[model samples]
Target chain A: MRSMYKSSLIACIVLISVLASYSFAMAAKKVELVVWDLQGYSDQQWYKNANKAFMEKHPNIKLEFEPHEGVPARPKFISAVRTGNAPDVGILNLYWVKDFAMNGWIQPLDPLIEPETRADFFDGFLDYASYDGKLYGLFTETGVATVLYRKDLFAEAGINPPKLLEAWDFEEFAEAAKKLTKDVDGDGKIDIWGIGISGSRTGGGGPTTFTQFPFFWALGGELIDEDGWPAFNSEAGLASLQLYHDLVYKHGVSPRESYSYTWDDIARGFSAGQYAMALLHNTHAPNMDKQFPGQVGAMLYPVPEHGITSATTAGGWIYSILTDDPAKQQAAWEYVSWMLSPEVMKSMCADIGGLPTRRSVFDDTMFASDWNQVFGRQLEGAHMKPGDPIFPLIQDEFAVAIQEVMMNQKDPATALDDAERNVVQRAKATDILK
Target chain B: MERKSGSLKQGWPYILMILPTFLLLGLVTFYPALYNIWLSFRNESLRTTVSSFVGLANYRRVLSDPFFWGALGRTVIYMIASLVLRVVLGLALALVLNIPQRGRSVARTAILLPWVLSEIIVTAMWLWILDHRTGLLNGLLATVKLGPYGWLVYPGMAMGTIVMVSLWKNLAFSFLLLFAALQQIPLDLYDSGKIDGCSSGGLIRYITLPLIRPTVTIVTIMVSISAFGQFSLVYSLTGGGPLRSTELVGLYMYQQAFNFLDIGYGAAIAMVIFLINIALSLVYYYALRSESLY
Candidate 1:
């Protein structure tokens, strides 16, 4: 009987040992999170450092990284959401938020975001995150269009670049472009163009409408009415397009080649000393600064003398959780909330050379010595594109018209009229008409 | 009929062996085509997962729009232009390579190089070569102190450049087919023409052209069909630009469906294009009806 009791005790001890080991293994298993984005790649130190710190702090978790760019990225994001195979969190463009929210592919973040944390960001940025009366994301950076120039080139040509306080109007901007446009090599052809703007998929009121829409808006042109119907084919719209045409065919200051340049090409060309000025954004300023130190300058977009429009594109990248599992969502929220902290936001915004979305980040030491002084002033009136479902369609139509005018295929009046007609016609076939 | 049924019953295992392939093909090609046809008749938007049938509305919308017709015209023009350039230049290159000369084998192999190049690589290369501010073409022009022409900025220039790029990309296909046809023209036929005191030109007209008819017809039709459905070249080249100067139907349909989120309308456009391709195939088959070329 004693021998049998000893055998039973051994068996029980083995079972208890196995159970304890299993418990330890389960506790040590690593949690995995994923992050996907495109912007952080070109300059990755910000993301790399943040990711490194996060991983160090949470040694029991793994974060997978994926990145894609161009127009095709949107469809990939949507497909990920639909399949519920999305990253724990992702950097999303504001344009896709409406479609994503409407399809039930993403959850509103009203529960994750507190009123105090929400108030930290500017109203315009928070407004970009909110759709249908609920917050779906947290804005991470400031995106607004601005005029970037070469101070050295401006000085050589005896033309002063525009300032944030005394911004140049339409005529003054044109005069500056002409003065700066030069045949530096004494060749008959122009060696350096005065100003460059995107006329293709990169910019020019189509795919990246913000780059060109503000040009029209600065002249008092509105793309859509409050009813979300076409409203751009007015006198103001025609005048804006006419100004573009004059710059191309008449003025000869803007490069005809701008029509072929993509968004990346515009900045690269400017860095190559091919243009005197570029209509780009603060998002691009840092990269430009890297390529040509002390060569980049910034100002508000050129306005017309009378109306003096202050409208700028307040578009910014937002961080949001995509997991459907409640536990995973909470975990993802932890990573997101940490990234949204003022320190991380400032570091990232500084690295990207864009304006900060958070009000507190403006007080960071880095912002004091940078171009934020001008970019911040411009942000006061910056606004996101309309949150309408058909905005993409509207932008495409507007882009086609802009391309037509720039290429001299149609006059401003003809192009805008045709575009307005096309948008209205297409809108009637869908829910956007209402 | 009884024998046929018996054969079918005996071939059941063969059918089973090929079933996976058939299933794959059906899923990838046939299913998508049918689903596209169904989408053409529905109202789909990003706002809803469920779509409702709206028969012929999308078709009506496409037909009534002038831009659709305008784009269709451009597609037809681009297709024909690509076809002619490919045939003429390809035939020339093939004839030159067919000559009995030194390094002919090397030249023939060299002709196939462009055909194997990735489309994106070719597009990027051309973009660099033709950039307005820093293009090789402009640099060469500056040698003569001539114009720095905007190769892709102007509408007409953009259209011509896309055609040229397409010709460059597809030239090898035409050359290879035509070279193969040239080799099979029986030497005796040419000998007979020579015996009749025929000139080189006469020999080509009498013997070469007649014997190569079937092959030439096949080559023409095949290249035309491929060009008719061209997308990647235009997409990467000018993005149908300087303002829709190069916007082929494929890019238009893509923009409508994917970019603009008008999937149903895009699907309708796809169906229309499919029918157009079918019609084109029928026309070519009739036009080129002949005995086997190979």
Candidate 2:
């Protein structure tokens, strides 16, 4: 019995040493970086290819991916941040960057971007990522709004495409819409609509806001002054709203159903030949191309009458690092730098249907051939929203104004007046008027 | 003194038996409630780990905010509409089901089907059925030469649609309770009422209502509580859209806490909601208690 006990103790000692050595060996292997995002659409195994190549170069490192839907992702990410369990890297909208940066949730990335590499990115792209004179995130892609139309339906109506459709004023746009609204099959009810502009709750609020900006900008209506005081109550602003109100109520070219359409609905409605035109984001076009072949074409938003140039809103997703761990931060910086490489960006734009934020990527022959040129065209005239803590509140107020006017809850003049007053009051209370 | 000491010794075993339940209750319920109350005083944000105490500022902001009042008012309206409809409809159906008829069991099962289905699935089904263009409701209306109407988009109709969904999903519990109450109504009372020349309406108005008043009151309270805290149906259906017409307190709280990452403000709103619900329930209980006494 003594001998048996001695043998068992020796075996136990051996097991412990072996387990310790195994754990040490495993720990010595390269660290894995986690990138969490919600953009889940994968085209023809492109991300898989990118991952394979990336892994081959960094054989010791691994990429961990977590995809989530929009509604649940917010809560999950907030919980993760609250518990100090955020991923090493994340993809978030540009509007979210300021909020995250102001709260110090994300790290400043200026130190990560070497001087030599800074020249590779577009200036506008770089500017969008910087806040308070510090870079906190890098834009993976840029998106701009455009009007997508069905070529077949346009041809069927015997209506020639408007000359410089991308630069047409409001009156020109309305005229084209009216010409396109005919019942081709002689059905008393209208089967095809002239335009599909979303005023609905489910619709992409960004695009709705984007689609409205040109009118305001063209009329020289400013949301804020040089010192950032509320300035949207100007005459130009009211005129812009008057046009939006007229688009739905007076001209009657846009569909009545548009009040409930989201980005997906508008895209799907256009693809299904229900509407002739849609105020759409460039990112949605590639997917629509796949879903409905050779049916759609895109143009930059129309210029406003008496405006110097056409304007559209430019927005996109950015990669933000959420950790302060030196090792993880180093790994994340490497991943981010690699992801922003011109070749990698081209692949991402092609694979994920996002626009490349770098101007150099526009030279790729693939963009011209792959129908991504629309993003290039739209980005040339895109505008960035003023980054502020009050931006989301402003967005909400703007959306409310749109609903009020579109739903006929109030007249255009009254709605704009109310919005201007409310925004001013909110700004005063929040000390944002400065 | 000897007997009292013996009783104290016996009480120790009972305490030991109740200890686990008390521990579980404290761990799960009491701890979070206390923690949340503490959190409401701090400027906790999703962006940072460090938080500072802001005292009643969160409550001040929440109370003064227009959206809060809008959501609260909408929630009250929704609660009243859904509670009334659920109780009335559930009682009517239970009364019908209590009659001696063929396939009564099958009918009861069919009526409870919506309650058994997942809330998300039920919301999705209603979403399709309420779609302005391709919805079954609109389609049927069109076939009958009635004009198609927007069921979910129109602001006046949005709350009605939500109330309908809440009623459909929650009425089954009330029905079951009322069915049991009906079965316990003592058949001889109805026979005596008939001999006294009481009409069916008079019998139900007097005998049935008075007898089942307590069960009905309980059902009303339960339905009111459920409706007051509605989250899933509104979230899935409208997302508080078309200009925040359908925004409920639960959704507003969620947006404030999760989307805006303002936990302190969110918590303040939550506490306010909790207080209001307690007050409302107490008032309801008192009114019922008085009615029962009379």
Candidate 3:
């Protein structure tokens, strides 16, 4: 009996030792987290430093970074998710959050993130990254549309540019544009245009919508109504379209070639002194300033007469996790948290000349500049693109309407009507609207 | 049955030798084609989780859409215009290059530069050259006191400008094929024509034209097929924009498939494009078929 009891005790000890060793080995095992980032991240110093620090902090988690260009990355990411070959994490345009979440291509980060961490993000950004009350991702940086104008041209024209937080009414803005347009050479040709707008259909008319939606919204235009139907063909919508048309044809202040301009074209043209003013994203403010010191200024978009309020569109990239494995999910969450932390966010935004999504990052000195403050104030009233999966189709139609009206192919009312009809048809067909 | 079995047994080695290629083609080419056709019959979209069989719905949608028809019309116009310019200019340049002259080799290489360039690079270069406000062409025109024109911005000019650029890029392709055919023509025939007091034009009309007729037909079919399916150039340059003035069928199909995530409808459009391509090839083959030379 004594020998048998001794044997049982030894056996129990052996089993416990075996289980503890197994658990330790599993805990120490390296988990490789694959991350797909927009192309050029590999070359950015901030990105490299963040990766180095992340790996140093989490020695057991290995990160595999794959760089892909934005244009081709969308379809490639979708294809990867469908084929079960998706990376552990991916950085996507904030507009894709709803679509991706709805399709179950990305997992919600709410479970992985703490409430305090979630609350640190700006309300607009959190809303942009959420769908159906679940937080799907966190924004990396933020962009808001503002009027980037030439300060020198404004001074030369004897027109005072609007203050940082101030805005111009439609009439004042149009008058200033007209005054700034000049034929300096006196060759019977206007050498410098007053303003430039992007009406290109690229990105499903993303540039047009991004820069022009503010005007529409300033007049109380709602892109998607309470009933989840497109309502951009209302009175406010017509007025906004007319404003764009008049700027080009009636006022003759904007270039007719605005119909083909992309966002980059507007930025480059503004830097080259082709236009006195340009309605562009504030992200271009830093680069423009760097190229031409103290020559560029930014302000809130102009409002129409009796306009409800001034508004601008906000957009940015969001980091999302696509993995189903718990270990990989945890690692991805750690990476996202580290990236979104105030220290990292501030450094990255400063390096890239972008606005940080976290509210705490605004406390930094870099964002206290007058130009940055202009964008920072605009963020207060900025609108995000609707999160509906069918919004892309609606945006495309809106692009067509903008082009048609600006090019004089159709009147404002008719253009809006046509676009509304198309959006409705597409929405109903997709079952997004009944 | 025994005789067939015997033949199969005799042919087994050849079949074994070609089996890998057949398998690869079946996997890569035939499978995707069949799957795309299958996808056309269903209501498949990236946005939706459930894919149900909705036979003929996608096809009906594509067929009834006015935009599809408009894009088709534009594509046809683009194809015809580019094809004509490519053929006429290709023949002219090939003739010029065929003449033995100083730096003829250098000239041929320089002419082939555009053809060898990637479509995206070519589009980017032309976009810079044709930009309305900051284009090299407009800048040059300004120096001469000429007016700056909206080469790519105007709806009326966008399609024509794209065609012109397309011609510049692809002229070398047709030129090379015709030039190769010119090289193969018998020198004796041309010499005889010359001895018979034939002018240069007469010699080319009789000997060169007839001898290169077959190659021209092949080049036409090839260029037509390429022009019909053009996507990267137009998509990158104009994005079928300026009020859909340059929206070709391929770009429309791409927008529906990738942009809108309506894969089923895009597949239907793709199938239609494939059928059109096959029909075009057949028409060109039969209409331009050459008789055998003795």
Candidate 4:
């Protein structure tokens, strides 16, 4: 009887110890979170530092940051979401939020964002983020398009630094381009082109589309209806395209080669003195400043008429929490909120040479000064592309139509008609017709 | 042993032997192919949560797409242009390298370097070479005072450059095959040709060319099929650009499926590509049969 009792006590003690250790092991395991970003290899160091800072605060969370190679990120992001393999957080072009949200691949961020937190972001940015009356993302970095010029080129051409809001419409812009365009070496070919606006995928052909498209928008031309149906065919739209044609074909102000230029191509060409003026963005301004030192100047995109109210396109990257886990969601928001805080936001923008999307950050003396001053003023007129599910497809069709017209594959009227029809059909198919 | 019954002893081992490969094929290929076919007949969109059968609509849409046609034509052009050049150039190089000469092994190894380099690196290098404003080609042309010609900016030139780059990256396989074929020609046969008053050209024509024709045909068909599916080099280099001039059906289908989130349309395009490859293969088989080369 004594031996039996003793053995039973030993077995019970051993079972209890085993269960306790197993429970402890389970409790101690760190929560693993994945984030997909397009920050690229060059920016990997910054991410590492930021991630390290994040990890130190939250010891139980392990964050994995994966950077995509290039433009393929869009497709990769879409595929991951569809296959239910999307990361806990996704950083992408702000334009993608609508498409992702529309597809129901992403959760509405309203549950994560509070009204007080929402108020901290710039109103224009918030407006851009909200689609169909729901908040889906947090905007990061300001992407305002500006006119970057070589001060040396301006001085050499005997042209004064451009004054504010002065309408340098089509003709004036062309004249400046002609005066600045010089072969210099008598090589019988253009050694220095006038202006660099990509007709290529570098900017998604955006320079031509963005810098030129705004003129049409300023003139009251619209590409799609409020319902995301086709609407670009108009007399005003042709007039907009004609301006581009005249610039490349007739005036020879813009480089015909811009059609093949990429984003880096435009900036590098400018750095190499291949072009006098580049309708570039603040995103690229820091590099321009570094490359040319004091030779860089900035202004709003040239207005249609010198005095016309210039409307800049609101663009930027967005960060969104991609998780169903409440703890991970809270942790991701912590990172976002920390990043968006005025102190952090100002420092990042100053370091990266972009605009801060937070309105509160504008009060910072560093942000209130020269370079940031330019960015702040530009942000006012900046507008966002419509946050419609069909927007990306619409943008692609718009680009194709513009290229076709510019390359003389189709007349403007016919090109617009075809684009309009394709877009409507696509929208209908996607059930966005209503 | 009495005749083996239909028993576990007889059947179990056969099942075990074939099971692994069968499972792997099912896992890797068969399932995905069936899924894609199923996706083709469904209405898939980023907006909708539900997938519904849309039947032939996706196929009709793909057939009517101008971008699809443009991309298909470009793919065919790239396929034919690259394959023909690869075959001719590869054969010529193989013949030259096959000569009894010093450092022939080194020559063969050196020629294969471009083919061995990673595709991304090759693409980055070519992009530097063809950059419009500050590329090496433009700079060299400037030295001759010939032109600041926009090599990559020009639509036609851009497509040609992409094809050329692709050919450079893949031509080594053709060269190796042809070289092997040349080496396989019996030494005794060449000696006989030499004895029969065969000069260098005559020897190649009568003995070398006819004998290697089989290898040449095989390489042509293989290269053509590979080039028809060409996507990466073009995607990396031109991105089917300067006005979508270099767009291939592969890139288009990719964009449709992934970027546009139109899986049904994308799958339709893939099926079209499949049909095209099948048709090309059939035509090639017919050509081979008519010549009775096999």
Candidate 5:
């Protein structure tokens, strides 16, 4: 009996030792997580540092980054997702969240995000990242449309730049633009234009939409009705369209060439001293100041006389996990959460000249500077683009309408009507209206 | 019957040797073409999860759309204009280089430079040179007190500017083909023409032109097809705008497929374009055949 008892004890000890070794080997195995980021974003010191720190903390996970640049990345990502070769995580524009979510290309973050962490983000940012009551991603940075003007030009024209958060009415803004337009060399040509607005259809109408939506929003224009039908052809829409038309044609403050300007053109023209004012994102505030110190100023967009309130369009990039593997999803969430932590968010926003999406990051001292304060305050009234799959089509039609009105191909109301009809047709064709 | 059986046995290895290549061609080329045709008859969109057959719907919609017609018209204009310029300019350059001259080899290499450059690089370089505000061309014009012109901003000028830039990029290709054809023409034929007291223009009109007819036909067809499907340069330059002024059918198809996610509609447009291409090729071949008879 004693010999049999000793044999059982030995068997149990060997089994426990084998299981412990197996667990250790499994824990030591490294997982590779593929990450896709915008080309420039990955090069930032803050991004690099955060990545290094995350890898250091999570020794069992390895990060492999593939950086994509410019407009082609969108189609490339779509193709990758369809082909089942997408990275574990990807950064997408906020407006793409809904489309991606609806197509089931990205997994929801609800299971991964804690309630406290979700509450940390600014109020509307999470809404921008959500579709059909589930958060699909996390917005890391935000930007609002602001009037970036040349302070020296305004001073020379004997015009006081609008104070921070103080917006001018449409008439006052038009007069200021007219005053700023001048032929500096007196060569019987206007060397300097008043304002520059992007009218190009690049980015699938994103640049034009981002820069011009403020006018429509300030006039209480709704892009679509509750049923996701075209609704921007109303009086507010016509008024906004007329405002842009008059700026270029009637007031002669903006140039006819404004019809071809992209966001790049607007920025380059403003920097080259060709335009006294430009409708640019607030992210340009830092660069403008650094390039022409004390010569630049920022203000909220102008509103119509009967405008509801001064409003601007807010847009940004969001990070979402695209992998269906539970292990990789957890790893991706860890990286995303680490990137959005207060310390990393503050550093990234400060370095990249973008507004942080987190409310806590706004309390940082770096965001308390004069220009940051201006943009930060602007964020308070900013409205995100609608999280609808059909929004891109709407933006495209709106851009066409703007171009038509500016080019005198059609009157404001007529152009809006055409655009509305086109959008409705597209919505129906895509079965989004049904 | 025994001899025929022996011949078949002898040919079996050769057929086996070429089978893999035929299989690869079918996989890469024919398969996609057939799939695209099938897709054109369906309602497949990236926006929706479900795909279903919608026979003639996509085609009918494309036929009714004014934008499609406008794009097709622009494409024909672009193709014809670019083809004529490339052929005429290419022939002129090829003739000039055919002469025995100093640094002829250097000139040949220099002429080929634009053709060798990547399309994206060429587009970027031209974009900077033609920029309205800060382009090299405008800056040069500024130095002479010439007024700044909106080369790309004005819808009236954008198409013309794109054509000029396209010519610059592709002129080398036509030049290379024509030059090679000129080389293949027997020198004795030219010498005989010279001995017959033919002038320089007469020699080219008779001997040079007749001998290079086949090459010219091939070059014309190739250039037409490429010009018809031109997308990258114009897309990068103007994106079919200042107001759809440069919206060629190819760009319109791309916008429909990728930008708007209307895959079925884009495929239908592709089929239409394919039919147009076939018609154009047949017309070119028959016209050149009649000329050859003369």
Candidate 6:
């Protein structure tokens, strides 16, 4: 009996040792991955849900989410990188990835991503986050600048409706815009404008450039030439500026009051039925669908010719890893890869009704609406802003000319020439024309 | 506790009390101003990793830029315009409120509402009202055959609208101070002026304005400093735009610092603005040295 009791006690001792070691191993496996993003208010729930689902799947990794806005957020991240305390992973605008990569603040994800994973995302977006053949990020939320128009208004005016299958030429588009403009109140003032173009230089130069760059592209103008010099003084640029001016002054489709509007104001005005057509991003699809229901129409930007080369600017957030710790790098890759996967992306894009960066994610049918399908197809033709590290500063300098021309303060040629000169001087000062 | 020995020892507790206050002020205000001054003499930009001592090159660059001088000119104009409007409107409101009229408490409370809210909030409220289309002001204008004017778009009108909004936000403080000053002035002065065959306007010129001279100087200095540093309102409202018609020096410094990413040049602009504010304050201080309120 005493021998039996001794064996049982020995077994209890063995069980306690094994249990303690297992608990220690589990404790050592705890990995805390910090992520910063600019998801906005509407998309916060997706991040929260992703965090819970990711943690449950891994059961050893804790995801810490810090959401921020765009303008103020970029500088904060830059400052963190300067201080050597940036988050393990974060989302930044694709334009900023160039500058961050130039400064060597963010690490290249090329070495981290596998071949199959790399094949999952579109090459058009992958090129945006690449600097000198090193892929630095994978775009998560993508947007394509496109024309949002009124289907009901087109019907009421008996216009050949714009379609994703065939975009309207500039001449036809201008004529249609003139017909849609109306003074329904008989007050001698136009109540409904034909187009919503943001003419304000408010909130920096971004709003003016994002909405107007497509028109410049269609007019055969380039913001910067192949040699990385300001080429906005070309005849095509003058024509594009003239087009913007004529919309306000000659065509009378846009109002003089629009000079006070920002991009936000333009969006609000479009929603308030102030404009029959507006240039907006694919990110605006869900809101447009909800507000105007089946009455809203989507189309690629009208080109100078109906079927010739068309262009739309693509911009949005890309997930970048900022840490040098290999363990943390692996953990961050897991989070980023999971976030960019087809299943997770389909869930997020469906929840927010946002444009997906990966082609495989769109096959889920949640984004199979006509509007979504159109914007999704346009992603193949969309490209990043010309490869310049100082593109934001360039955009700012160029906006003065756009504002001057649109406000009728200066003619297009003089304004474009002056803007190009200013850009040249600034580029020389910064010493980074490329 | 026992009695302290030397004068310095006796003042130890008082010094300890004020020490934290000084440290807080140094951390919050003086340190940043000095650091900015130090930065103004260096070459600091995002493109360069190491900042080198440039010795007034940043200042030279900013001073030579035409945008800087234009912004400075507008800032001076903005300060003077805002100062004039605030004093005049504040004095008028103070005089009216000090008359002991009906609903006087309600009026006093309502007068302080604009000043109590933050400048950004007030600017947003004003932006909605002053928007060119579908604004309260424009809607009211439409009732008549009047304008749905671009009040915040036209150059001169944008600056004027900013000044008006600044006045609306800051007038209450001046009004309260002037009102307090008015109360301290015995009613006997006004009665005596009346007894001596003085007109109401005459009484105000000699008795009221003279008595409020010191308070007006304080009000001018306070309002001028606040207006000189106005950043958020213009940053949010007009973005100093319509071709920078309303670009204050503060907004110029921000665009230089962050947008242009040249911290040295931005610091130079700030130091210049700071020096100008000090000179203006000194001038006002000497100009309004009151000669006995009696």
Best by TM-score: 3
Give the per-residue Cα lDDT of candidate 4 at A209.
Answer: 63
Q: TM-score of the A chain in candidate 5?
A: 0.95
Task: Give the interface RMSD of each candidate.
Answer: 3.0, 3.4, 1.6, 3.1, 1.9, 2.0
Tell me which residue pairs clash in candidate 3.
none
Clashes in each model (backbone N, CA, C under 3 Å)? 0, 2, 0, 8, 0, 0
Q: What local lDDT score does residue B194 receive in model 5, on the 0 to 100 scale?
A: 92
Put down candidate 1 lDDT per residue, B1-294, tens digits, no spaces: 999999999999999999999999999999998988998999985455677999999999889877778889999998888878888788788878878999998887777787899999999999888887678898899789876788877777888888888887778998899889899878898888899999999987777766767777777788877876788888877777767788888888887777766788899988888888778878877776755433
lDDT per residue (tens digit) for residues A1-434 in model 3: 99999999999999999999999999899999999998856788998899899999999999998988875467778878888899999999877778888888899888899988888888878877788899899989988898988888888889998766788899999999999999999988888899988889887898889999998888888888777778888988899889999999999998887888899899989888888989998878888888779888887788876333568998888899999999899999999899888989888888888899887888688889888888888888788888787688789999999999888889999998999999888877756677
Candidates 1 and 6, the one with greater TM-score:
6
**Ten contiguous residues with the weakest lDDT in model 6 chain A:** A425-434
Error of 4 at B194 (Å): 3.4
Which pairs clash inside model 5?
none
Root-mean-square deviation of Cα positions for candidate 1 versus the true structure, in angstroms: 4.5
* Predicted candidate 6 versus true structure: per-residue lDDT over B1-294, tens digit per residue: 245467778799999999999999999999998999999998787655578889978777877787889998999899989888888988998998889889998998998999899887898889889988767998998789698788888876999888888877888998999999999998998999999999989988999999989999999999899889888878878998977898999999998788767778889999988888899999999999786765
Give, for candidate 5 chain A, the lowest lDDT window spanning 10 residues: A300-309
Chain A TM-score of model 3 comes to 0.96
lDDT string for model 3 (B1-294, tens) is: 999999999999999999999999999999999999999999888777679889998888888888999999999999999889998888988888888889999989888999999998999999999988889999999899885888888888889999999998888899999999988987899889989999999988878887888888888898988888889888888889888999999999998888888888899999999999999989988877767643
Candidate 5 on A167-262: residue-level lDDT in tens? Answer: 789999999999999999987788889999888987678889888888888888899898778789898899988998999999998888787889
For model 3, the docking class works out as medium
TM-score of each: 0.89, 0.87, 0.95, 0.88, 0.95, 0.93
- Report lDDT (Cα) of residue A255, candidate 2: 59
Candidate whose DockQ is highest: 3
lDDT for model 4, please: 0.75
| Cα DockQ of the candidate 5 complex | 0.61
What DockQ do you compute for every candidate structure? 0.47, 0.37, 0.68, 0.42, 0.61, 0.56
| Second chain TM-score for model 3 | 0.92
Q: Which scores higher on DockQ, 1 or 2?
A: 1
